[model samples]
Target: MNDKSQLVFCIGHCRIDPTDNSITFQMQGCSPFANETTKVSLQPKFIEVLSYLALRHPNVVTRNELVEQVWEGNVYVGTKALTNAIWHLRQHLLPLAHSGPVIETVRKTGYRLLLEPEYEQLNVLEDNLKIIEAKLDTANRHMQFILLFMSALVVITGVIVGVHLYQDNLRMIDTQIKVITQDPGSERYPRLSHNRRWLVYGASQPSGNKSLFLKDLQGDDLPVRQLTSLNSSELRAVWSADDSKLYFASHYLDTDECAITQLDLATNEIHSLAPCSSEMGAIDISSDGNYLSYISKHESDKNGGIYRLSLNTQNAKAERLSCELTCNYEDRDLAYSPDGKLLAIARRFSNISEDIIIRNLNTGEEHRLTEGLEDIRGLTWAPDGQRIVYATENSGSRNGFIIDIKSAQFRSLDIDGMSYPNSVSDKGELVYHQYRRQFEMAYYSLGGNVPSSLFPLLYSGGGHRNPDYSTQAARLVFVSSDSGYSEIWISDIHGEKLEQLTYLKSRVAYPRWSPDGLKIAFIAPDDSHEGNRIYILDLVNKNIFALASGYHNHGRPTWNWQGTSILASTSDGITEFYLDNKSPKVINALKMGVGFAKSSTEIVFSRYDVKGLWLIDLNYPNRIEPFISDQIFNAGNNWVLTKGGVYFKSKNSTEQILNYWDASTQQVTPILKLPRSSISGFGSLAYEPNSKRLVMTLDGFPQRDIMLLKHKLLQ
Candidate 1:
């Protein structure tokens, strides 16, 4: 083994600089494996283990040897610590691991480096210094003087820039945050009174229902009063001009209708105002208390719009406000200015891109404030109305941002898990909702006479979803946020040998494999349009390319049997995309085209206005027919197509059942009952033909609480 003092090892395509204890690798033509490169820092012990393995390259480094070398022979601690060291080292070498496993584990012995390594023993910097000394002794003094001057200048410039960045970061993170509610249930939609005497928020009850709770902020340890006891959810409670009554949005679980209600503080009575949309908690009151503004969808409209109802007039009807954007845009999360002259709205163009826009109430003019933003959770205006604070999301990371209405300049609060900005008080205090959640993956057997068997596949600190299997490659691709951001990951069909794939630092989903298994196509957000864009990853080059450039918002993408073209869902219908830059062909009849038959030209799809699965043939694209219409399916993407039939999950009033539609008989048959609780909204499905198993993701109950921030910055 070589000495560990000064050696730079190149393991496959990744370069390890032990001098700095950093590993550098290329991800999308950029590096993110070191402290100077990315915020993801590598553990020093993990690097030591890797360095030991490389020194003994191609030879099995026994567990005892690594433990003695890296952990100083602490048998009890080194046993498990060595295992974790190997795992983290592999994660850092993910780019090279995808091609082939960098470290191969010996079954009963130890681990060996599979990738060949090359290292140099000499230090280049020391060699350069000796050469400079020799040149100075030979009277070549001009070159020495020029090099020393340049070195000093570089040091001075680096110091100045470093100090500036340090100061800027300090200013950006100078906010004090405190979690106000720490109960066991989900709490959200916090509203602080204008006088700063009371704070109101929604909390989950023992019956698994949401209710409003009010706390007196003026006194310590005061009894928190229960404001609402409705069986349904009471959310978005706002205060009136005099704080005498609370106006809130309520959704009935039995009827599934959302409406606004006013609660009288004196008599403890509730009055109905107007009907709302399923998107609850998007209601706000005007400053003068003359009108109530909310977001709701008209029956004939595709997306919801901001609507205003006159609260002072009898028999007042809601009218949709004029939006200066396209028809496909969705307007939500609104806040009224303190003087009622402006309305701040979060407009979503697609799943990936959203922005905050200020709408003039008097002139009916709208202007954009923020652009290319991720999921805007909530928006609120400051008490002075000169600045606005909003919450947005990227992957699983949540951020709180404050923007000046006059200058349009903003900065992040740098507080993590700050999900929703509910309200700001006159005392310059901010109240918001903090949330955290995760999902896990599991598999269920579909084979003979065995009882229902659910096997845990993957569970970690973060979430995993959108699982897809490739029979030809014997690998599974899915999206996981275990690395602190949502990225594509791959593992064996048995959920072993996991490797991270993409580092886009954005939200991605719905990965589908090509027929040849050498490429993968997935859907990621594009800020330029109201729909998500399709990206194709070529395993050969390890590069990602967009499917097409257009305004069409692509849905879940599926590959053709030949793998030359991809069929994706659009607003109107399905469109076929080619790899050779051919013009896209649109088919208006089919909404989401998913799987292809093994030996036939038929493709399974669903329609927007229909209740069941439909199919179309490649030879006859116009001839579309219903494949299974016996019962309404839960969601379009909740089922997977295979050669035998279509395995789908259907929910009744009591339980959710997994059913299969046979290709030979064209009949639906019940297989087994599924776990009703904790199932994700559109629990996506994947199947392995050889293994006869189904994969799905399940979510845990979200942990939410109301948080308060105190700072003079907002003031």
Candidate 2:
């Protein structure tokens, strides 16, 4: 064998028969793997983190560095956590003799890998069957010319398609586009007239280039006009009581911070209020325009939170509305009730679900009107001002609810599963947006039930949270806490049999099938921590459980290079430590930046977080690294890692573009930009190596989208 083929490695759990050099696992009962399994488990995330440190430095990687990756920088009490994870790894692997070299301590630094990696060139042709392919071309004058021709065709053709569809969309809106202006794009937050007959939105068009515009909501032929414009000025305006004045924050680049500017809507005259700039949070004025309240994020004292600014002195009298010891509470969402006696504000970043909180000015006491909402993004007082309406989400389903100010009873508003809700009427009429399959729209209602299509199609895959359009891209698999409160469930793309996979009394998320389609590993509710833990379930036996006491939050586990034992894990709360515990210690953790060239090692799903999405090599020892690291949130990679790289989605601005990251270079480059939305939610991935098709899901207006991207890596 040539010495150049020394990249393959196995420390403890890996075994290679001399005759063929095919990898083998030491685990006794584990079954074999197939070439098409790119969807790996969650356990490997923990182990993958550890392997990165081992491969990158070859020596001890500081525990602090390791903990940062695992704990996400919360090193508060991490010393003890690191000790436990390492202790478990040593206990499990010491006797395996498979861990190529021992993990040695460097006194003060970190741990190190002692042995050399052990080997042969992988044949890429073997995995070609698994890929759903497209034409291949190298980047050059030819490819660029083809791309240019396609771009021009799409622009001309896509516009034609867009205009035809947009006409239909306009009709469905039921409300006319009273004003369509080429907006300046940044100005005041919009507020409508009390009668809901006119519209107000930030207008950043030419002239002031930063102001407001009004639209006749009565479906008129009125042209859009800039209501408030100031030369080279930046402003954000809201509605003042009486609906005669618009209040906004402005930045006087030359003289002041973003200050509050009020415009007499009746006269079209602007008033540059002192000290009310963009620096201060949103402000709410009294019904009589006598008193005003806004958030001052620059907390001067523990008690100085929501403040009242007087027009006379411009002096803000501050009061602490919440305590932050137990939860992260920030001042926001301040609004004036019709009576002007009650102030409604939303507190965010609090560990507990935030909500619409009302304060009685006279009593200086506050009360919460909403609860159990993971996020109370925004709030507003109803026309009657007796209720506080806000948006919420639970287990990925977006909805809105209104709370009775006096009774504190939450009446869930029957809007489509939507977001960004705001009341648009004084007569109890509500207008919000719901996502359709391809675009978003402004929906309207009169104080009651939401409108439903005569067509009964579920936009969000029937509320199936992370819908995967199957490996064959024919069916779907998603984990829904909805089934008896959030468990792993599989269904067809159109919502067929809602089969349950676990009977455990806890939640199961992030499920993945083995290459051979015989087993799955999932993140489940830990009987110990009551949080997430990794569990392996054999589909054949169905009764057995493989729990990883070694790692906590053992994310979705993936099979290792040999498919012998899973690439199990342990983490330092921040960084993941890859351990091939087929028998004992980590058999052989792969180098930091490598992927399998073998057909069988394509990563099932490249998982991601703040840092980025990662690609894994399955056919070898666990080697994990970043795949795409842009702001591409909530996406996964399904690939057939045969030769050059695994194919997945790359973020091209807000779009999910088809791209291939080479296994050899560990570098990703864009291939085709997918205009279609993804099939799964953020981070959901389904790849059929044979078909070479990758399916992903992403958030879209009114509905989540499942996207199918077909590609091939001929290079």
Listed in order, each prediction's TM-score against the native is: 0.70, 0.46
Write model 2 residue lDDT over 604-639, tens digit each, in one string: 333332334555544343565555554542233333
Best by lDDT, which number?
Answer: 1
List the global CA lDDT of all models: 0.75, 0.47
Listed per candidate, the RMSD to the true structure in angstroms reads 13.1, 26.0
Summarize candidate 1's per-residue lDDT along 1-715 as a digit string, tens digits.
2234646767655667766777776333323343333323355677788888876778999999998988777554466557656765766676777678889999999999998776654366457558878977877667688888999999999999999988866655446788788887778889888777789888875446678899887775878888876667776788988888998877878888877788888899888788876525487889999888888764455467888888899878877784533565778779899898899998877656678889998898998886556688888888888999888876656778888988777777776777768667654578888877667778888776868766778857777888988998789999888877678999987889998977765678888889888999988765332457788888876756666546446777878878888887765567788887677788654677354544446677755556777777877888887777736454456788887788877765445677787889977888777644445654478898887888877655578888888665566
Instruction: Candidate 2: give its CA RMSD in angstroms.
Output: 26.0
TM-score of 2: 0.46
In model 1, which regions exceed 4 Å deviation? 1-185, 203-233, 252-257, 268-270, 279-281, 322-328, 426-428, 448-456, 459-462, 482-484, 527-531, 593-600, 607-610, 618-624, 630-632, 651-677
Q: What's the distance in Å from true for residue 542, model 2? A: 7.3
Q: Which 10 successive residues of model 2 have the least lDDT summed? A: 706-715
